[model samples]
Target: MTPSATPEPSPAPVLVLMATLNGGPALQEQLDSLSSQQHTHWRLHVSDDGSTDGTLDTVAAFAKAQAAHGRDVAITSGPGRGFVANFLGLLAGVRDDPAFVALCDQDDVWLPDRLQRGVEALSKGPADQPGLYCSRSWVVDQDLQNPRISAAFPRPATFGNALVQNIAPGNTILLNAAAAQLARAAVSAAQAVPGLPAHDWWLYQLVTGAGGLVIWDPEPTLRYRQHRSNQIGANKGFGATTRRFSAMLAGRSRSWTDANLAALRGAAHLLSPESATLLEAFDRARRGTLWVRLTAPSKLGIYRNGTLAQAALLLSLALRRL
Candidate 1:
């Protein structure tokens, strides 16, 4: 008689954190995509920021359906501050849990292998060391059609690069146990700071600053839907470039940089000594004279993604706008 085949081991659990604020229009599609993930070992925790719409109803129905499959979904009332605060609060709530954490946007459609790819990439690294995996996305219109790949950043992901630019899109970020722990430890400090620019940018800085491993996969993992109501849309093409430059010229970059630096300083103890020193140097460079500002990028070894962006950064420094 033939012996029964061995059962496959269950995959590691991942805690997916999603922050929502009136995301009803496309929430169902996003939930369906999450249910379709190839790696089924995931639990979802959504923090709603006072949604007056049917977002909670959609989540409840999804939760009821998923419960039958042995998957769990939890909902919580957010801080009601904003998306940044809502995400930070979610991170704080899961600070003690050892499962891998993934940030999800309310409107995007994740591919089936999204969790599998991120989990596999992060699994190869040392368990004690922080590991963050982020991937490119296929930019799609509101209806998920007219797909085009997001711009690729070939530069190395480091603390220095994260100080000036954010390449890791939040929707695609996956943090291993160690990295999630680090983020949880620092969430309180981050929440104390007002107007923290973006949680994804802060995670990019925090992971790299703690000397963590960052894997930037070039393959597209999800459909990044661009619509009129998106909090942050796709940043590609000449029109977007022009808008970015214009924003910088209008001193928006400086404001964002200020907020980021303040938030980072509040969590300075969580960063490595080397990263702390680099952060201080960059902070000082921003406060220096015109000549110092002009030479700061090369001296501090901070950079953006492409040559055009790098040039624009230099110009912003020269104009005292960054």
Candidate 2:
């Protein structure tokens, strides 16, 4: 008699994670956008950091209202877990029960196919070497219209293209189960290291470090709404000389030279030598005159040509500080 073949493992549903704050006005817009996705296998896991403005209660009420209709929705909260920690906290929520995790911001509105397109890309890759993928997004005003994003960066983002600048936002990201499992470790590494920015950057590094792909989807899946309350809004000025001067005077900065150097050095262990070399250049960039730093022995010419990741990062860092 012929022996029965072993069955392949089944795929888990996608989990959408959103970290909320005083997101009273825009929270529903985002949630409504998510609920609009044709892909219904996904679940929304929102972590309300801390909001005196009824943010948690609003989310709770909405989830309950949605659940009465049999929607797979839930609201969870932790102490003021900080923005970065709130994103990481979801990993703990799903660590024992892993799923394809998508990072959702409290404000942005996703298009109908956001999660569907991401899942198609991720589901095709080898599960053992899972990854995170982000799509390009339209930078819009608080009204989510006019072309703020196009005016700000006005360039397509590729893994290599973003080497000097990161145009991807958390709301547009989709991290696989493997990456979710590695989130805590990645955070710990960042804490132990120095210059790493936040959960998003660390997740990118850790997943890509293990030979996993950090795919870039060029489609604009999000209406990236810009407002004052955002932690890191879409930066319009290109290292604007006036803004730079103002930034310097205002003492707004993301990293000192030493801390950035350490973070880059730490990432070396998480990426290929070629990628590591690039990260080193970015790390040294915070030191000033990256051209000069690139000439140093320890510094590698990561942005040899038209690498844009550094500029994107600078914009985000500057925007965050501002």
Leading candidate by TM-score:
1
Q: Give per-model CA RMSD.
A: 1.7, 5.8
* Steric clash pairs (candidate 1): none
Off by over 4 Å in 2: 1-12, 69-72, 79-81, 147-164, 191-196, 236-292, 296-301, 304-322
Each prediction's total of clashing residue pairs, residues at least 3 apart in sequence or on different chains, is 0, 11
All models: lDDT? Answer: 0.92, 0.63
Q: After superposition, how far is residue 1 of candidate 1 from its true place, in Å?
A: 14
Model 2, span 60-175: residue lDDT tens:
87788778656667677754747866776666577544468888898888889888888888888888675788877888788877864433334433233334334446778887
